[model samples]
Target: MVVLFLATSFFCVGQAAKDRFKDWAQTPPMGWNSWDCYGPTVQEHEVKANADYMASHLKDYGWDYVVVDIRWFVENTKRHGYNQIDPRYVLDAYGRYMPATNRFPSASDGSGFKALADYVHQKGLKFGIHIMRGIPTEAVKRKLPIKGTDGITADQVYTTENQCKWLKDNYTIVADKPGAQEYYDSIFELYAEWGVDFVKIDDLSAPIYHEDEINLIRKAIDKCGRPIVLSTSPGATPVTAGPHVSEHANMWRMVNDVWDHWRHLDHLIGVSQDWFSYIKPGTWPDCDMIPLGRLSIRGERGDDRMTSLTKDEQYTLMTFFTIFRSPLMFGGDLPSNDDFTLSLLTNKEVLKMHAESSQVRSLYYDEDKTAITSKNENEDWTYLALFNLSDSAPSDVWVNLSDMGMEGPVKISNMWTNEVLGTVKGKFTQNLAPHASGLYKIEKD
Candidate 1:
C-alpha cells in the first residue's frame, strides 16, 4: 500500500487539486531562522530577543516566524560543526530528544517549548523548529518505545540504510514497519501540543529523496489536527520530484546554505534559473536563508561580522529574492541590524511584488546580465528585474516593453529606490554597477 501511494502523482486541475495546507501560506513566508548566525546553539533568550525585535519592528512588514534551528536538544554544541560528546543529548523515556533546558530554560520539567511558543504567540508571531529527518539514533540504541503503538519499539521501525551522510543524528525510519508511521505521528503530536506553527525537516529532500518518509510525515501533520506549515529542505530537491514535493511541502529549498559571499550569491542566480518554472501560490522554491545583517555569532562558518555584500550587491540580493518570490527567511541577529540592513527588510513596494506577483519568469540571461519579469495578479501591473553580473564594470541593462507584455508610453518606476523614470515608448534602460540590480513596476500611462 505504501508503494502504491508513493507511485501516485498528485497532479490535478481545479479546486480539489489545491493543497489543503495552501491557505497556511498563500504568499511565501517571511521570517527569521537561527541557523546562519546561531547554528545549533541558539539560546532561549536570544530567540526571545529576536522575536521581540520582529514583533516591534517587522511584523507589520509581513515578517512573522521566529524559528529555532537544529539540535536544540544537544548540549556542549560547537560554534563550528558539532561536538560529538558522550551523552550529548537530553531525551525523554520514549527516546525522543528534548530541549536542553540549560539553553532553553522554559522547556524545563517536560513543558517542552510551550512557554516559549506562548511568548511568541502573545507577541503576535509564529514559532517554528528544525528537526532532522528520522528517529534519533539514541532512541533506537536505547530501544525506546514508540508512542501510539502497542508493544512496538523504535529499533523495530528503523534502518541505517540510506541515512544522512553528513549528519549522524538519526536513522532512517522504515515506513512500512508497524510503528514507523506512529513515531512520526508521535513527534508532530508533541509539536502541536507545544504550539509549533511551522516545522523545517532537514535532510529530507537533499542528496536523496525519501518519498515514503515525506508521505508519512504529511499524513502525521494532517492527523495531528493542527494547521502546522511544513517546510522540507537542505537541497537541490530534484526537479523530477517537483510534482510530489509541491503537493506535499509548503516550501522546499532549491539551493543549500547560501551565505554572505559573492560566490554563493552568484551560484544562487545560476541555480535559481532552473527553479523559476516551479513557483506557485502555495508551494515556494526556497532560495535558502537571506544571509544579511550581522551573522556568525555562534555559527558553523566564519567569525562575527556584518554581511560582506556591498550596497549594490545587497540590492541585487533583495531584488532577486523578492522578484523571484522565494520565502524570505532572514538569517541574522535581528536586534543587531544596521540601518542599511533594516532598510532592506522594510521595503514595502518590493515586498508587495514578492507577495502578490504571478507569472514570474526569467526573460533572458548571459555572461554579464539577466532579466526577469512578472505581473501583479491582483492589481494587474507588470514587474521587471534587471541584474548586472559583471566582475567590475557597470553595464547598461535594457528590457523591451513588448517582451514584458506592455506597450509604449508606460511608466517604469524603480521599486527599490521609488524613482519614476517618466514614460517610455519602446524600451527601458538603466546602467547598473557590477552585481547590482533594479526592480521596476511598469504600468500604462
Candidate 2:
C-alpha cells in the first residue's frame, strides 16, 4: 500500500514543473514565532531568553527559525493619535527596529539584533523578523529615511490607498515601479546585512492589496543574493493568484490569527476544507501557531489565558497539522511550558511525521471528522491519521484501503505511543478518543 501510494504521488508530480518552495516544505518547516503567545507586545529580552533556550535545548530537532513578530519598528505615536510611541513598542532614533536598550542592555544601538542573529547562527539555527506590508507611516512622516534612497518621502514610494485598516497606516508600494524596486531592495539589503533569513510580512491581505509587491519582495531578496524565505500573512490567499504567490512565497497564512480556542479550529476546518488539495510544497497554507503553552494576555502575567480545551482536543489539533505537513510554529513560551505541553512538542515520532512526511494530503474527511494521510516520496512508509473533532469522549473509525488498490496484509504502528498493532488485512479499524486523533504507519507485507 505504501509503495502504491508513492507511485501515484510521483506520477502526479513527475511531469509537473519543479517548485523550489514546495521542495523545501516536504516535511513541514518547524520554528518558533511570537504572535500567538506574545501578540504585539513581544520585547527583545523575551526574544533573547527564548532564543537561548531554543539553542541550548531544541536546536537538534530542527527548530531553527527565531522570528520576532510585530510592533518592532514604531518610532512615533502622534500620527496614530497618541502623544508618543507606546513605551512598550518603541524603536531608537535609527530607522531600524531593535530591542529596547534598557530591557535588552546587550543590544546597544544596532548592535543587539546582529549579536542575536549571530548567536542563533552560531548555535546552528536561522534568525528571522516580521513586518507589516507597507512602509511604516511613522518612518515616512518623521523622514527617518531609508537606507539607500535619500530624501524620498514614504508617499513617494507608496500610496495612501494601500494602507492596512486594522493596524496603523502603511503606504503600499507599487512593485512594478522602478523606484519602488529600489525602495524594497534597500530594505532587504539592510536585513541581509543583519543576517536575517526569513521574513513574514503582514497586512498584505486586506486594504492595500499589493499582488505585485509579492513579486517585488522576491526580486529584492534575490537581488540581495541571500536565500531568505518570504511568508505573507492574514488571509486565505485568493485562488486566482495561487500560481503567482506560490512562485514567490515559501508560506502564506490560510486563516486569520488562530487562537487557543476550539471555535478557531472549528472555523479553520470548515474554511480550509478545500485548501488541503492546494497544500503542496513551497507554498504552504499556514494555520497559524499552536497556542497551547503559556500566554500573556491583557496586561496580566499569563492571565488572559487560552480557552478551556481538553488535552485530547489539543493533541488532535497537533496531529491533524502534523499529518498535513503544515509549517509548525509554536506560539507558547519555552520556559513556562508544562509537562503535557512539553510532551506534545517533544514527541519525536509525532514531530518526525510533521517534519519528514513525504506526501501530505487528505484521503477523506466528512461530518466534522477527517482522515488524512502522508507518505514518503519512495512510498516505503506512510502515516494514516484519523481525527474525531467532536466534544464527545471517543468514537470508532474504520479506514478503507481499497482505493489504494492494495490486496494484502500490512503492518501498522501507533505513532504517538510507539506501540505496534500487528499485521492486519487491507481494511483497518480503530477507536479514537473525542477531540482526539491517531497517527498510524502502514506498510505492505
Candidate 3:
C-alpha cells in the first residue's frame, strides 16, 4: 500500500508539471532575436520594424517571435554600452527591472511592455524578452522591497557569490532565503500581466546548473496564470541534466553563442549529437541563433556587414539546424537581408524538416564529413543531410541506404534546390562543395 501511494503521488506530480506547459511551444519555436543585430540597445521602432517585416514577409513561412534581447532597462544604454557600469537602469519599487522609457517609449506611464506586446500580437507574432536570472545588483544595494511580501527586501534573497561570471549587473538569488521564491514570483507575475509570451533567462543554465533557482522560476512561471515559453541560454548544458532541464524549460541552449564562423558551425555538429536524445515534443536543445545576412550593425561584436559565411556554408548551417530540429532564431537584421538570405529563410521544405521531423540522429561524423537523418512523424518521408566539414576540394559525400533502414530505388529530392534527382539504389551520393551540405528527402520508389 505504501508503494502504491508513492507511485500515484509521483505520477500526479509528473502529470501536473507536464500539463502546465503542455500548451506552450507544441513544436520548436521559429523566430528572430535582436541580439546579434542590435544587441542591448534595440529600441521600440527597431523592434516594430522587424516585427512588421516578419509579419509581412516571413510569418507565412512559420517565422514569428520577435525577441528583444538583453538590457532593455538600462537608461542611456546606447552611450554606456552593454557591459559597462550604468547606475541609471529603470526599476520599480519592488526592485524588478522595467523597460527604460527613453528606449521603449511605449513602456512609459507604467505601461511596461504591454503596448509593445500588443503591437507584436497585432502583427500576428509572439513577443519575447531576455532577462538575467536574478535580482539586479542595484536593487540589492538599495535594499528595495520585495513585492507581495511585508518586510522582505532584495538583499535578503540575493547572494553575491552566485553571480554571473561575465555580467555583474545582477546577483544570483539564494534559493533557500526567505523571500527568494517571492521575488521570482513577483517578476513572472508582472511579466504575465505584461502579456509576455516567452522569456529567455540567461546566466542560470548550463555550466552553472542552478537547479534550485530553476525550480523556483518554473514554479513562478506556472503560477503566473499564462502560457510563457521558457528558454535557457549560454549553454554547453550538461547532457546529464537533460531530464531536469527538459522538465522545466521549453528550450535550452546546447552550445555557447554560435556565429557565422566555420569553426562555430563545425562545433555545433558534435553538440547536436550529444543532445539529440534529449529532445522531445516541447523541449528543444537549441543550437543558438542563425547569424546570417546583415549582422552586428549596432551589436557588441564587430562592424556591420553581411555574414562572413560563404553561400555554401550558409546552406550547410541552415540544413544542419533544420535536420537537428533546433529552434531557429535568426540573428540578422531583418530589414537589411538580401535576396539570398531571404530565400534561405523562406524555404518551405526546409522549415518542414524543422517542424515535422523527429528521431533525428547523426548517422556518422568525422573530420571531413558528417551525416544526419530524420523522418516525419507519419514515417512517409525521410530526411538526410550530408555535410562536408573539410576545407579541401569538393568530393563525393555518400550515405549507404542500408544505414537509413531503407532498400534501393528511392526517389530523392534536394530540399534546398527543390530539384528531383531521379531514383537511386544501394547508396546516394552528392558532389558537395567544401564546407557545403546536401539536404534531401527520400521516399521508396
Per-residue C-alpha lDDT of model 3 across residues 277-372, encoded as one tens digit per residue: 876788888999999999888886777889999999999999998888888999999999899999999998998888888889889988898899
Clashing pairs in 2: 21-282, 22-281, 22-282, 393-434
* Candidate 3 TM-score to native: 0.96
Task: Write down the TM-score of every candidate.
Answer: 0.95, 0.85, 0.96
Summing lDDT over every window of 10 consecutive residues in candidate 2, give the lowest-scoring window.
76-85
Top TM-score prediction, candidate number: 3
Sorted on TM-score, best first, the list reads 3, 1, 2
Tens-digit lDDT track for model 2 on 65-164?
8897765554322221222334334433434455555544556766646776887788788888888775666556665655556565455666776567
- How many steric overlaps are in each model, in order? 0, 4, 0
Q: Candidate 1 lDDT (Cα, whole model)? A: 0.90
| Whole-model lDDT per candidate | 0.90, 0.69, 0.89
Error of 2 at 180 (Å): 1.7
lDDT of 3 at 95: 96
Report clash pairs, candidate 3: none
For each of the candidates, the C-alpha root-mean-square deviation to the true structure, in angstroms, is 4.0, 6.6, 2.0
| Model 2: residues with Cα > 4 Å off, grouped in runs | 1-27, 75-103, 143-146, 206-209, 297-307
Higher-scoring candidate on TM-score, 2 or 3: 3
